[model samples]
Target: MISLTSPVETRAHHWRAGIKLGALCASTLILFFIQNWLFQSAFLALVIVLYLLPGWRFFTHGLKPIKMLWPFIVLVGAWHWWSNELQQGAIIILRLLSMVALANLVTMTTRLSDMIEVVRFLTRPFAKMGFNTRALEIAMALVIRMTPVLIGKGQKLTWAWKARSHRRSGWRILLPFTVLALDDADHVAEALRARGGLTNND
Candidate 1:
């Protein structure tokens, strides 16, 4: 099993792995947006192949966690069945699934530090544009890192509420989530200030 002694180290590892995967995903997404055909097919094929990676069984790993949303998917499928040709609908659905799976893989394998460096380097050329690369990098890193934490918190909160037989009330749960999330945001802002993140004026 993969083991890490600290959250920072874990996040750093994730950042690196994520940047590599995210690069591909981001590039493909852009090409799709721009209708670029040069490598779109290749990227789509890569998306399919990535599903065959270790621990990526669609029915087991992908579907199981989000099984609660199966009804929604079925409803979408039915709607597609009615409103459009099945062939076109199939392509859209498959593309959506591929994008989601690729994103999951990137986030799962990447660390926040890796994301920070990627953003920093990407923004380096913008120093002349008055963009604070450090601040942007830190913000992006924190946002990426918080996603998993927020999900984990939501799950734990749901479980605790269920154990106490609470009705999954929104206000009570949202209170803690909002508070903790704000605290994390504040911490990130302080860290940025300490590091002189806004160095664009210099």
Candidate 2:
């Protein structure tokens, strides 16, 4: 698996996974209560500073996932502009970008095994109630690992569309992207079954 954890280590990498995750959750909740664009913008700036503190390469790598958000950001901004709710749109975009950046910071700093252990600990109560959590843990790990892979595949498909046609790719690549996603999922399921599925002991 391609590890999402950044190769350039920072002080944040030393923090406990549970603590970082707890902080991320608390900050995200607080962002919902904040409606002021000034405050949201300041928070977003603070997140950017946090990224910079990890050094240049680390900062750039942390931002890679955020590139996928531009389409939604543009759409939201355009919608709000049409509705004359630009302030609300700005607040939403800033809040979302900041929270996602902070979350990405946590993911980059924390190891996957550490995160899985944290999830296992959190889900222990449900496990005691006879619910199986191994699948849940595996699913979370797969999401973290596969998101970038899927995004890259979509980008490649878009590029292929552009190469073969004079028109902009835009939504034209959606069908192929969906097909690729389904194919990847099928392959993943087959691989897991071949490996006897993810067990609690894994």
Candidate 3:
């Protein structure tokens, strides 16, 4: 499996995963309380600067994940425009982009194992209450790991559709994408079973 963790090491990589995650949560919460677009824009700029602190190559690599948000950005912009609430829309878009960028930054720097351990620590209380959190942990890890894979697959499907047909490939790709996701899920399930699944004892 291709690792989502960036190969280009930065100072942020040396930071503890728990601290990075805690900061992300706190920053995200504070973002919601701020309603000014200028403030939001400044925050976004600060995030971009933080990304650049890792050097040019790492900064550019960090941006690749943000491209996935273009669709949501466009949709939100359109809705706000239609409602004649452009300022509100801009604030929303900026907030969303900033939060996602911060999250991507954390994921790019932190190792998967570290993030998983943090999650396990967070869920310890629930686990003590007779709730099985092993599956939940596995599911969270899988979702984080598979998101980029699915996005790449969708992009490839779009390109293939474009190559074979002159017409624009729109919703037509959804069926194949769904099938591809299901196929991948089946393979993952098989692999997990072979490895004894995610049993609590394991």
Among all candidates shown, the one with the greatest TM-score: 3
* Candidate 3 clash pair list: none
| Selected candidate, larger lDDT, 1 vs 2 | 2
Candidate 2 colliding pairs: none
Ranking by lDDT: 3, 2, 1
Over 56-149, each residue of candidate 3 has an lDDT whose tens digit, in order, gives 9988888888888899999999999999999999999999999999998888989888998998999888888877778987897898899989
**Alpha-carbon TM-score of each model against the true structure:** 0.59, 0.93, 0.94
Give model 3's TM-score versus the native structure. Answer: 0.94
**What are the root-mean-square deviations of the candidates from the true structure over C-alphas?**
6.7, 2.1, 2.0
In model 1, the number of clashes is 6
Q: Candidate 1 local accuracy as lDDT?
A: 0.57
**Alpha-carbon runs more than 4 Å astray in model 2:** 1-3
**Over the stretch 91-118, how does candidate 2's per-residue lDDT look in tens digits?**
9999989888888888899999999999
| Candidates' C-alpha lDDT | 0.57, 0.89, 0.90
| Pairs clashing within candidate 1 | 14-110, 14-111, 15-110, 15-111, 15-114, 18-110
Candidate 3: worst 10 consecutive residues by lDDT? 1-10
